[model samples]
Target: MCSLLRSARALATTVSLAFIFNASSVLADVPQAYALTDIGSLGGYSVPHSIDESGRITGYSYTAGGIRAFSWTQSGGMINLGSLGNDKSMAYDSNEAGTVVGTSIVNGQYRGFIWNAASGMSAVPCPPAATCSARGINSQGVVTGYTQIPGGPYRPFRWSGGELLEYLPTLGGSQGYGAGINADGMVTGVSYTADPLPHAFVSNADTQLTDLGSIDGTTSYGKAINSQGHAVGYGADLGNKSAFFWSPELGMVPLGTLGGPNSYAKGINSADIVVGQSQTRTRATGFVWSAATGMLDLNEMLLGDTGYFITAALDINDAGQITAFGKDSYGRIRTLQLTPVY
Candidate 1:
């Protein structure tokens, strides 16, 4: 009887130890935390829009002259991307080749521009009297954006080879926007249907647009696209906005907020890691989302007391490097880069 009792106890102890080991292994597989680096401004304040694979960042920063586009690197610091003329320029996206695309006020008119080290800022030719802006660019230098025709609706367009302009098809309404492009030349943006409601959409390589329906039937905007053709953005239902991830397999899935009703996903990477801002109980907070983790507050992942909380995560690279905007205790905004610390 004593021997049987001992055997039973031994078996129970072994099972408990095995369970503990498996649980610890699962925890070890979780994502790594991040360390913050404050990339200072050009002058007053700065807002980062995109971060490329090589850690190059492009955005608009306030200079004494005005708001000017800038490209920043770890070694070179911030270099102002001169305007098309003598006005303001705001860079929206940059490709791996260091090509920057954005809109600049040229000769008192808004014109889309493509800039590279070889060629200085050059305006993307548009129809006469039309105001255009380049919002996103891919690895192949394909640019996507919108052109507003005077007395007409905004038309989404794709520019290639610095010359040809391909107008994308609208759902049914007149106004549409091209916000992002992937390495495969797929574009994602917002389009209004016959219902006159804005719906997120993704375009195939053939430029055929597929409407990604909204979460609650109100409005949706596709902000960025990933290598897998997945898109991330925000969808609103009766004015309540929620961050969403749309895939070819799954339609629009809401990424719930951190105890609030509003969230906006702005950037996604090849790994399908999504970063954005969410409204927490107190204020707007930056967040990172993955398949394993639904949403993790970036503030909770800070390695040390960075003295500022991230307000919005604008872009994340394949290396898990995130470019974001942070607000200090005094409400001053600054651009920051958060690198994954394993």
Candidate 2:
């Protein structure tokens, strides 16, 4: 089970004026700077997972009873997407239509669920006695995640409004995990290959999985995919990990660390701007990366002194809005939203 615990802006323009002036491509839709806003929690603490182009954020927050899935908007604040007769629910992704997907406990079993303003919360179809999770949903409302029967390996699955679409093809291995879906119906995730090593994979229009090799390591994971089919994730070798960006033309390229041995890329927008966490010489910090700027410490791009030390960026929308998690001055984890300034 993925624990909720596991998962920037700007005076940024003035400092990166050189890179902005020398911009080589429009793919560098880099923000000049960002204004940060603390997205208040439900009660105890909140962890956000995905942000959509409309700036809608979905994730889980602690409540008086237990963890509950929620979606936050600028106008609506935090809207609880209650679970399916249980106290535990986690929302991992949302689409342009405001459809959210994640896992919920139903009758003591973890089952995938989909929620929208129209339908509210509904269970995603899965095989009998199978545990399922809905990790990502696309603009078209296609859902991607994983399912597993008792004593069997996890199998990546795709679903739509009503039924399970199909089990995604694997790289000849027994286990697979699907994380994100793009508007084109492409799914990005990790699969165990015949060699039994975990490898990142992306599905094509034909629904076939293609392995995206590692960043000089034996393991790779495709965490999220954009509408353009580009994917972002991390690769691991032994104990060291490196974040990477993958495109059909460029392949997988490691986004260098902030100055330390480990970095993890978790989110990317259509503009190719990447966001994640990297280890700095002194501490772990959030980062935003692109071909034009390489990588910039997100903490250094703040417009003013925020009492938060950003540690990981979870998602970025095409509008350049970012949802991230960090520690406040009191060392409590907090969820934040960053909006780009012109």
Best by lDDT: 1
lDDT of each: 0.85, 0.84
Q: What is the per-residue lDDT of model 1 for residues 1-342, given as tens digits with 9 covering 90 to 100?
A: 433333353245335433643554521222578989888888889999999888989899999999999998898898889898888999999998889999999778889999998988988877768899999999998999999888899989888864568999998988899999999989999999998999999999877999999987788999999888999999984457878888876578777677666789999987667899998778999999875556789999998887888999999888888999988767788999998988
lDDT of 2 by residue, 118-172 (tens): 9899889887689989999888888899999999999998887665458887899
Off by over 4 Å in 1: 1-30
TM-score of each model, in listed order? 0.89, 0.91
Q: Which residue segments of model 2 deviate by more than 4 Å?
A: 1-24, 237-239
Give the distance in Å from residue 49's predicted Cα in candidate 2 to where it truly belongs: 0.4
